[model samples]
Target: MRDVLRIEDLVLKFRGYTGVTEVLHGISLNIRAGERVALVGESGSGKSVTARIVLGQLQELRSAQVQGGLYFEEQDLNRLSRRQWHALRGTHMSMIFQDPTSSLNPVFTIGVQFTEVLRRRDPKLSKEAAAKRAGELLNSVSIHDHARVLNAYPFQLSGGMNQRVAIAMALANHPSLLIADEPGTALDVTVQAQTLHLMHDLVERTGTAVLFISHNLGVVREFADRIYVIYRGRIVEQGPTQAVFENPRHAYTRALMAAVPRITGGGVPEIQDMDGAFFDPLEVHGEDRP
Candidate 1:
């Protein structure tokens, strides 16, 4: 498959009174057409920042300095004007943020927001037609009571329901790429699993390449075709999902895998990045890569 999104040596920095604080240190990754790729790291590891930059969000901030090439379909994202970037967002790319509450408008009814999203792809679509299409989209994400959902505000619904609504809106246009940031992290384990499954099937059938950002190794194992292990601000290791799971090369990757709580209730091992040995780049290649 051809690469739908590619980041080459991306570096992001925020200018502050204290000085420039570098958050991402020349990180690079990509997602091919219809491929699912994961970027895994603990909090403050710059996973979400990478996703934001890819979506052209960072370019909107005056204080943010984004270096390196960000390409979507061989077009340089850096070269795009703000209006041009806005035009690409909803139809060609969309993002489901970490929290449904944050992504969904608090004041607007879900139906209204859903219609607005649908309009991004079809400007001339009537509200009545958009409403009907929204209902079908909601149903695709397992939200059966589409009428109630459309009429209700984000705060009125349960976390899982709101998340389903968020997913429904994100995939409404069948965008070429989706950036899902810790999707379902706010819901209960069972609900999270169900949400993930629904999202997985929808994206697969629509052929939408996904850049899944999360700290959950177990979820990444099941959801991603390839995995990129990040530590601090750098990509420490990357390989095919099973290859990384079977033999995590970097100390951080091994420690991260060992830290996952087992279903059998085994002891969670202490992380041993041991003297910061694994902070350097650990590249995996050949048969192990996707």
Candidate 2:
């Protein structure tokens, strides 16, 4: 299968009065067409930063600097101009943020917002036609009350409901790549699981490649076909999700798996770092055997 996205030796830096701080250190990863991949790490591990960079969001910041290759279907994303990024967003690639409330415009009704997005990809689309398309997209996400949802504002809906609306809008254009950055963070566990399952089903039906970014090991285990474990801005381990889960090669990866709480009434086990040199560049990119 052809790869939908690829990153080669990607590095990200932020410069301020305190001086330049490098966040990502030559990170390399890829996602095949229609495949589900996960980037797992704790807070401040550059997972979200990597997602933002893929979406071209970091370029808007004057203090941020990026190096290395970001390719989508062999197109070099790093070289894309602002206008090009704008054109690529939504139509070719879309993102689902952690908080739907913050991502959606509070003042605009869901219908109006959805119409704007729909018209962006096809300027000639009439509002009625866009609404119909939006309703269909909502239905694809298992939302049956399409009319009521379109008419409701972001603030008027529950977190899960807004998230469903967001998911529908993100997939409305049938983007080739979808970046979901901890999309279930704000909802309750039940709602989060439901939303994720709904997303999984929709993506499966659409054959859309997904880059799921999260710190939740269990969630990733359920959703991703492949997983990449990142620590301190570098990829420590990567391979088929099942293989990596069954036999984690990197210390950080083992630590993360050990940290997952079991249902058998045992307290969380302490995560131990394996005995190995931490700064060896070649050692950082170990891949588990399938």
Candidate 3:
């Protein structure tokens, strides 16, 4: 399979009065066509930053300085013009954020928002065509009563429902790559599982690669084909999902694993001094593991 996305020595820095604080430290990874890859890390581990950069959303931040190479479909993203990037975003690459409340427009109805997104992808499409496509997209995500949803405002819908609608919008353009940043973080466990399963099925059927960013190791294990463990903005460990979970090489990775609830008998094992260990990037691969 061809590589749909590639990051080579990618770095992101935030400038402040103190100095430059590096958030993403020369991270490198690749996602092949139709693959599901998860980036697992703590809250400030740069997982979301990486996804934003991939979607061409980081250029707006004045404090942010992005360096190194980001390639999508053999085209260098870092070098793309603003117009080019805008055209590519949502059309070829899309993102689903952690919270749907802030992402969705409160004034607009779900139908309006969805149809607008569909029209953005296909401007010549008529209102009826857009509505029909929006309904199908909603149905594909297992949402029932499409007409009711279309007329309802974002605030009227539950968080889980809004998230499903958001997912439908993201997939509306049939993007080649979808970046989901803690997509179901605010949802209950059951809804999260259902949404994840729906997303997995949709991506599989459409052959859209996913770069999922989350702290949920269990979810990663279940959904991702390969896993990249990021710590302090660098990839500390990466491998096939089973290999990374079964034999975590880095102490940070092991610490994350230890934090997961143990269903067998005893609760999660006690992890000591995990905080300081992940503060700085650990060079486990020693320039060998790209």
Q: How many angstroms is residue 131 displaced in model 1 relative to the true structure, after the best TM-score fit?
A: 0.7
TM-score order, best first, reads: 2, 1, 3
For each candidate, give its TM-score against the true structure. Answer: 0.92, 0.92, 0.91
- Summarize candidate 1's per-residue lDDT along 1-290 as a digit string, tens digits: 68999999999999999999999999988899999999998888898889888888887899999999889988999899999999999889999988888789999999899989999989999999999999999999988998999999999999999888888889999999999999988899998999999999999899999999998887999999999988879999999999999988778887666555567964444444657543222121111111
Model 3 misplaced stretches (Cα beyond 4 Å): 263-290
lDDT of 3 by residue, 137-211 (tens): 999998979999999998888989998999999999999999999999999999999899999999999999999
For candidate 1, what is the TM-score?
A: 0.92
Clashes per candidate (backbone, < 3 Å): 0, 0, 0
Of candidate 3, the 10-residue stretch with the lowest lDDT total is 280-289
Higher-lDDT candidate of 1 and 3: 1
Report RMSD (Å) for each prediction in the order shown.
5.7, 5.3, 5.6
